[model samples]
Target: MTTITQTAPLGDRTVRRIGFGAMQLAGPGVFGPPEDPDAARAVLRRAVELGVDHIDTAQVYGPDVVNELIAEALHPYPDGLVLATKVGGARDERGEWVRASRPEQLRATVEQDLRTLRTERIGLVNLRRQVGGPEPDAVPLAEQLGALTDMRDEGKLGLIGLSTVSAGIVEAALEITPIAEVQNAYGIANRTDEPVVDLCREHGIAYVPYYPLGSAFTGGPRALAADPAIASVAAGHGVSASQIALAWLLAHYDRMLLIPGTSSVAHLEENLAVDGIGLDDEDMAALDRVAHLGAPSF
Candidate 1:
């Protein structure tokens, strides 16, 4: 059977491997406030109650909407809770993601997060790069790290992280500062970021897959939870396909910390129940084959 430890060291703190992502707490398009603010708050509280110590969010998510919700839901955050937010971007009037990786821009963004999050300091801040990847001409990766480093030095941020970046970018950033974690679009079927994952393991950095359940945003493919292989495995285990997908991630990487997001208390509880659902060698083998199972593997 493939078993995984429940907690992993994140900087000085150890958080449950299955954490919470605050992106979905916002409204559609990740813009504006959620339709049901009370319901969203309930999900956040329930996650913590279920022992989710790592919460990932960003200032750009809902253009400060999610951060505000987090504060409203879980202010005076419980001890051991790690609040991770992303920088280097923002939402425009049309709710589109735009790069703001300049050093000054990053500094301003971190300061803004402190205000909205209602905290003296943020636990983690990932420098979310541009869609097409890093452009040296726009703003060198070093400059972005420098901006974050300065804040880290001043005690405004606990540990620096990176998102949507290449292994080369991680290498470059390492020379400037120690990365506590890396968040990217990775899942059982979407194994394109394998190289980055290998690099993270080499350096002891925690790997957090943003869409562990897969996403429709990535070229509008079917959800990974709907994959035939995953569904079959779920049936054998008598659990949701979502649980099988998340369990595979934990079993696959010891350092992986999942931040699967949801806005409902029921789904939140279902996600938290992923712990102790053992996946045997046969199940692991079938899931391991998901990445190469033809088109729309999800």
Candidate 2:
């Protein structure tokens, strides 16, 4: 595959913006080792070969599996590649997401990420807040981001970011440190984080949407895949509905960095190829109407 020309500023480096998310490389429910480890490694290697530079993964992914696969596939890590991970949660034996964002937990998680990824310092580390759902371990902003900033000073984290946050939290985190990016659940179908996206755009910070495919939205991925508006736009562009969803995001905002995850290399190429599918004014208008079609606002 040819290199995508579109780029976005991530920290001090500029990346292709259409990056890979390694969450799907893990096993069922994002826990344990994947059934096919060699397949996962191949996918990771293939992604870098296809010009994917920004890879989003977490230590909790497989509780450690995906990071190792990434290290095995691309440990020497090509130049201009940025590996971003999150801290704030871990998985129990049963594979439940357990919030663990205390200062101590943050420190340990950061350390573990460095060890697993075989990097002395991570390119970017996101302080994932336990918001948007009921959780027992919600720490104050100062405690969470403060630990990360300390690590940054110690040269363990290159850039700081926030995940699963609101606009107010983004503003607040700015006061704590220079936030390079914000990863939130945003897509054409879920506008709950619209305000945050606008805030990031206004400040020139990267807005990396995790579920850019709208898989976890109100009506699930089928709702978006089966939508007439998206399908019509896809037909005009001769791309799939999913490509329309990703391209719409790319067209909607200049700073939007997509991290759509997939285990299959074929699917990875398809997701990364969205930059070629352009959306015009009429296509964008039709897609904008999709938000009104039972799309949830949070």
Candidate 3:
């Protein structure tokens, strides 16, 4: 009878491991309002009704559009609901991500999230580093984390996290502040961050994988769709390849948390149903070899 609705400590709060990622709620290219605002609101409400309490977002997502929809749909968030947001990135007029981690900009984005989400204080604020784009900016790590620390001292944030960073950055940030979570791109096919995940697990930090299904670089679910082992496992479990993909992540490590983003109600339900697909030792063994299953070239 166990379900994926299990709760774990995220700093001072406990939230379900399988939380909702609101990035896709934004429009194409993660800019402008969603094509269907009502549908976005319904997904937020439905996630809560399905026992999801952790919701991850960033101010750059729709440049504030998703936050507005979140507030409109589930403001005065239910107790135990952890609202985790990010700063250090902004979208230009063309809907491209730009580095904006200057101290003033970080402060402005944090305050903007407060206003957009209509919350007095944010539960968790992650300082998303900007070093993954085609032309990554040389963001100063000390200055960025310092700004968030000052805000946390002033009670604007409950906990702090880092995104799209390496183990070195994690160690450096730890010296300046306590990181409650680390968001990065990781999955069965993409084991590049395995060391980082191990480091977080050792320190009991939550390793929230942003693109469990794959990111724009990793082929976005296509990475798994073409894998016969995953499909075979899914067939044996009576689940879809996507569910097996998620379950593989959950079974890979205890500290691993999933934030699969989707705009459809049916897809959201399917992603959440990962809790029902229990991977036995054989299944885990098969999935454990996925990293060597001619892992995608991306």
TM-score of each: 0.94, 0.93, 0.93
- Give model 1's TM-score versus the native structure: 0.94
> By summed lDDT, which 10 consecutive residues of candidate 1 come out lowest?
289-298
- For residue 11, model 2's alpha carbon misses the true position, in angstroms, by 1.9
**Which residue pairs in candidate 2 collide?**
none
Residue 48's lDDT in candidate 3: 94
lDDT of 2 by residue, 10-127 (tens): 8788989799999989998788999999999999999999999999999999999999999999989898889999998877888877787889999999999999999999999998
Ranking by lDDT: 2, 1, 3
Error of 1 at 292 (Å): 6.0
Worst lDDT 10-window in candidate 3: 289-298
Question: Evaluated with lDDT, which candidate comes out highest?
Answer: 2
Backbone clashes, each candidate: 0, 0, 0
RMSD of each: 2.7, 3.0, 2.7
- Residue-level lDDT of model 1, residues 149-205, one tens digit each, is 899999999998998888988998889888999988888777888899999999989
